[model samples]
Target chain A: MNTLVLTRNDLSVIVQAFGRDALMDEVLAQLRIALREYDPSRTQSLRRQGFVYEKPRLGVLEWMPVMRVSRQVVIKVVAYNPGNPDDVGLPTIVSTISVYDPATGHLVALLDGILLTALRTGAASAVATQILARPGSSIVGIIGCGAQAVTQLHALSRVMQIQEVLFFDTDPSAVASFPRRTAFLGLSMKSAPPNVVARASDVLCTATSVEVGKGPVFEDSDLKPWIHVNAVGSDLPGKIEVPLSLLKRSLVCPDFLEQALIEGESQQLDASEVGPSLSDLVKRQQDFEAYRSRPTVFDSTGYALEDMVATEIVLKHARALGLGRELAIENILADPRNPYGPLDVQASRPAQDRALP
Target chain B: MNTLVLTRNDLSVIVQAFGRDALMDEVLAQLRIALREYDPSRTQSLRRQGFVYEKPRLGVLEWMPVMRVSRQVVIKVVAYNPGNPDDVGLPTIVSTISVYDPATGHLVALLDGILLTALRTGAASAVATQILARPGSSIVGIIGCGAQAVTQLHALSRVMQIQEVLFFDTDPSAVASFPRRTAFLGLSMKSAPPNVVARASDVLCTATSVEVGKGPVFEDSDLKPWIHVNAVGSDLPGKIEVPLSLLKRSLVCPDFLEQALIEGESQQLDASEVGPSLSDLVKRQQDFEAYRSRPTVFDSTGYALEDMVATEIVLKHARALGLGRELAIENILADPRNPYGPLDVQASRPAQDRALP
Candidate 1:
C-alpha cells in the first residue's frame, strides 16, 4: 500500500460523498491536531519546493522552503523571475510551503509548496472564523478580490455559513459575475468598496498581492469592531494589506508570530502591538467565542501546519472513501516469494554472510 | 479540465499500456526535450529552493517546500511524528503533493508526495544518465540497497543493457539475495566488498545515505578506469557518500551544479576544490566518458527539472490512454469554459456588477 493519487474528479467525488460540512470539519479538526502536536523549537528544517512557470523566455521559477513548529508552520515564499513581471503576463509572487513532521526525524513530506500557500491561506482564515466569527455568519466582505480571494470564499463556505457575500476588487469588474460562478452556493452577491462591506459584514476577508511600500488595502480605523478579518492577500517578502494603526486597536491573532512579525501587518507594528498566535487563543481557558468582545483580529501569514492539516484531511478522507490511487512506483522488495522478507535475504542467518548466485 | 491524477495503479496501468520499454522511451524523450529546452542560467532565484528544519521542545518538525518553476506548481509535504520510527516501526517519511494553477491562485490537486520522491528520483537519475552516460553501456553496481534503490534499478533497466550486476551491502543478507531479486533482468549478481564491486561495474552507483567525516565507502584505488558513478544518496545539507579523492579524479557532473556543489559529494572538498559545475563541462564539450583516461564522474544530486520531465511523461501517457482523473479545482475564469490556452490569463470582459440573491 502506498500514497493514494486523487485527481480533480476523484476529489470532486470525495467532496460530494463527504459533503462540504464534513470536509470543513475534518480540515479544522486536523488543523487543531497538527497545531497541538507541533512545536517550532524542536523541529529541524523546512521543506524545499519549487514552481515552474514554463512560459516562453520567462521560464520563471520560484523555490521556497518552510518549517512548521509550535502550533504553526512558518513559510518563506520567494519569486524567481529573470524577466520582469511587467514584461510577461504573470504575477511575480513565486512561493513554497515547508512542512514539518512533529515526530521522528521530522523528515515527513516535501510537497508541492505553491499549492500549500493557497490552501493554508484559506484554511487558516476558515479556522479562525470557525472559532471567532458569529455562529451564523452568512455575509462576508471579500476585499481585494483576486485569486486568493476565491479560495477564501471556497474554504470559508466549507466551514462556516455563507448566505450572502460582497466583493471589492481594485478593478471592480473582476467580481462582476461572481454570482454566476458561485451560484452553486445560492448566495446573492453584492459589489461595494472595501469599507462598505467591511462595515456591514460579520466576517471580512482581505487577500491582495501587494508589493512592499504599496498603499494598504483596508484601513483598520474604519473596520467595525465585530467584523472578523481574514488577511491573506498581502503575502510577499515585504508586503502588507491591513494597516498597522488598525492592527494596534484590535486584539491581534496570527497563525504564526514569526511570519506575522515579518510579512503580515505585524511587520509594521511595534513589539507591544503584535498579538498572540491562533493556538494561544484557541488553547486559552477563556471562551473562544468571545473574540469579538475586544475586537479580535487574525493577521494570517499562511503557515505549514495548515498544509499538514489540509493534507491529513485529504489523506484520511481519501483512504476512507478510497478517493485516491495507490502507486507501486516506490516498490520495496517485500515479496513473499522468498522467506527473508522479499529482498530474498534470510533473516534467520547472519546478514553479512549470504551466498551469492 | 485540470491536472489528471494518476494513482500508482493508474500509473502502473499507464506504464503497462505503454509497455515498460515505451515508458522508458517516453522518459528518454522527455529528458531530451527538457535538456533541449532547459536553460538553468535563465531561471531566477525563485526557482532555487530549500527547507527550514526547526527545533522545538516537545517534538521535531520539518518544513518542506517542493516546487518546480517549469510547471508553476508548488507542493508542501509534511511528516510529523514525535518519536515515530522506533516507536511505530514505520518509515518516518509521510508527505503530500499539492498542485496549483498559480495564475488564478487555485489548488489544482493535492497528491500524496511519498511516492513522488521515489518516482522523481528515478526519473532524475534517468534524465542525468540519459544525457551523460554512454548508451549501450551497462554492468552496474549499487550501494546502499534500500527503498530508492529498487526504482533506480527499474528506471535504469529501461535505459541501458545490464550484463553483470553487483551488490555490496553492510547487511550480508542484502548482499546475498541480489541474484534472485534481479532475476528478471537475467544479469549476473554477487556479494562482494565495496572495492570489489567498484572495480567490476562500468556504471558505479553510490546511493547510500552516508555523510561527510564518516569514513569514505571506497578508496580511489578501488575505482575502475572510466567508471561513471552516480552519487544520489547524499542530497540534504550534510549527507554525502563517495570518496573525495575518487570524485576529484573524474570530471564532476551534477544535475544542477549550484545544488551539488553544496549538497553532493563535493561537500567533502574544501572551498578550494569546488570548480566549474556539470553544465560548465557540458558546454565545454569535455569528454565525460573517458573514465580511465580522464576519470569521468557525475555527482548525481537530483534537480527540479526532472520532476517536470516526469510530470510531462505521466501526462503524455495518461492522455494517450485516457486513464487518469480530471480536475476543476483551479479557478481559471477563462473566456471560454475550457482549454486554458497554456497558462493564459485574459482578464474576463469586465465583470458585470450584479447583486447576489
Candidate 2:
C-alpha cells in the first residue's frame, strides 16, 4: 500500500497557502469539537483512548502518545533531551506524526511534528487568550523566548491587536537575538526582567524550562489586576510556572481538567481548588464577566486533540494541493487472503541467495 | 532532519541479507533482555511504560500501541477492520512503525510493520516452543492456515527437527492453497480435521480469526498428552481458541501477565488461575519438567518489547545494507536557535498567498 510522506518543507508550503489566520481558525474550531468529544471517564480504558509510554534514560527521555480521532488514528513519538541544543546542535524537543486509516490500520501519512506542535500549541493559547484575556488588551508579556515564543506572538496576533510585547529569557543570547527574528512582526518589542514584564502587561505568558519545586518565574508581589496568565511551560507534573498563592487566589481554568491536574500549573493545587476548564469557557458554561473580574489563569497543558486537529488540517491541505509523495512503505498483497504473496515474488530466485525460499 | 523510509521491499532485502536464523537469534536474545527489564508494577506510569488506546467504532476497532525502548522510541499505529479484505481488498490488519531518536526527538526511520509484526510474533512463539514444547516432537499441527501459519512453521523449524505437518482451516480455499507456499519448506504435509490434527500432533498452534465468545475450536478431550499449544489467535478480551476446560487443566504461561489477563486465552480464567509468565519461563524461574509433564499452553498476546526488538533489528539491518531512502521530514535548522529559517525561504511570496513576512 502507498504511505504518503509529507516533509517539513511540504507542510511549510501548505501553511503558507492557508495562512496563519485560516490555520488558527480551523484548529480553534477543532478544539471546540475535541472539548465536546473528549471523555475524561474513558482515560484509563484502552478501548477509546490511546496509550502513552514515557521511557527515561540517563541522557534522554522519550514520550510516545497515541490517539484515535474519528476515522483517523495518530501516533506521535517525541524525545526531549536537555543537552541536545548544546551538545548536538539539534532542537531540544523533536517529534514525528504518523496518521493511519482506522478501518484497515493502514498508515496514510507521515509528518514532521516539531513545527506542527509549536503552531498547534500557539493556537491553543490563542484560543484561550481570545476567550479569557481582557477586552482591548494591547500589551503582552512573554517569559522564556524560545522557538515557541515566535508562534505564540503570531497566533495571539490573529485574535487580538497588540501594539507592544515585553519578552524576557534567562539566556542573554536568546534575549539579544529575538528582535531580528521578530522584527518582521512590526510590533515594538521591549526586553524586560520577569517582574517588570509581569507588572506592566495586561496579559502574561510563562513558557520557561525552569525546574519543578523552584520558585515561580515572577514574584507574586508584582500586583497586576485582571491580568490573564497563560501558563504554558508548566506541563509536566511538579513544573509550576506561577506561584501556588497566585494560582489559589486567581480564577483558574485548565485546558483539560484531568491533564492539568497532573501536568499543568493547576497541578500545584488540588482539583477542587481550581475553577472551571477551558471547555467550560469555550462552551459559555462559565460566567465570563465574573471570571474576568479577578485575576485569571489559563493552565495550558498541550492536548492530543490539538495535535489531531493540526495533523488532520495538514494532511487535508497536503492532499488538496498534491504536496506529499507516496512511499512503498506498506505491503499490500495482490491476494487479500494470502499474506505470503510478497514472499512468493522473491521465492523464484535460487535458494542459496535467500534463506526463506 | 532525515527520516530513512524503509519500504517493504527494502526490508525484505534486509531480511534476506540477515537470514531468518540470525534474525530470530537476535530477537530471542532481545527477548531475554526484555523479560529481565519488563516491570509489571510500572504499567500505569508514563515513565517506564506507555499507555494504550483502543478505539472501537461501529464499523472498526483501531489500536495504537506506543512504546519507548531505551534511547529509541517506537509508535505502531494500526487498524483492525473485518470488512477490509472484502470491501476494500486491503489486509484485515494494517500498520506502520515510526522510530525516533530519544535524544533529539528526531524521527530516524519509518518501517512497514506488517511483515515485521508477523516475523516477531512467530519468533515469540518459537521462543516459547523452545522453552516449553516436548523434546523430540516431530509432528506439528497448525489450525487456520494464513500468513501467520507460514511464519509459525518457519519459526518452529529453526528450533526443531520437524518430520511432518498437520494443517487445517475452516476456509477450504486456504486449505487447498497451502501446499504451494509449503513447497519451499519441503516438509511432509497432511490435511486433516481439527480433532484429527489435535490427536495426531505432538505440538499444536491455533491462529484463527474466530468470533469472540464462540465455542472452542477443539474439544478438551481431543488434545494429546503433554502437548504444547501456542494459542496465537485469542488476543482480544473475549476471543478464545482453546476450551476453558483445557486452559484450566494446562499449565498456562502468558507473555505478560497484565496483558494476558486482559487479551490472552488466560483472560478466560481469573488472574489467580493463570500460571507463571513467559518471562518466568524465559528466565527459568519456574519448575520446567513438572509444568511440562502436564498440558502446556503458551498464551501469546504479543508485547511492546517484541516490536521494539524487531524494529531495532530491521533498522540495524537496513542501515548496514543501505536499503532505505532518506526523506526530509524533520526541519533541523542550521542555527539551532532560529526556528523561522525555513519560513524565510518562502517569505518572498505574496501576503494573500501566505501570512508571515
RMSD each, Å: 9.8, 4.2
CAPRI grade of model 2: acceptable
Give the per-prediction TM-score of chain B: 0.73, 0.86
Q: Highest DockQ: give the candidate number.
A: 2
Query: Candidate 2 lDDT (Cα, whole model)?
Result: 0.71
Docking class of 1: incorrect
Candidate No. with top lDDT: 2
A1-357 per-residue lDDT for model 1 (tens digits) = 343344444555554565443555566666766665556564323332334354543332333333444433443334434232234433333343333334433322222333334555666788777777767777898876554565577678776667788888665445664545444445568898777877777888887655567757766555566677777754444677776666776777877777677667777787677666787766762556666544666888666556556655655565777664544322122331121123222212232321221
Per-model TM against the reference: 0.65, 0.88
List where candidate 2 sits over 4 angstroms from the true fold.
A17-70, A342-357, B16-70, B285-287, B345-357
| Cα lDDT of model 1 by residue, B109-197, tens digit | 44434434455566556545544565566778788664455556656766676777777766565455555655544456766788888
lDDT of 2 by residue, B1-357 (tens): 688999878876865666555666676667667766666444221211323233443233333344454445565545455456657887655667776665567787888777766777788888888777778888999987866777777778777888999999888977887777666566899999998888877788888777668747777775677888998875456778988888998889887777788768988899999988877787774567665556889988766667777888888888888888988887567755555554554443333532323
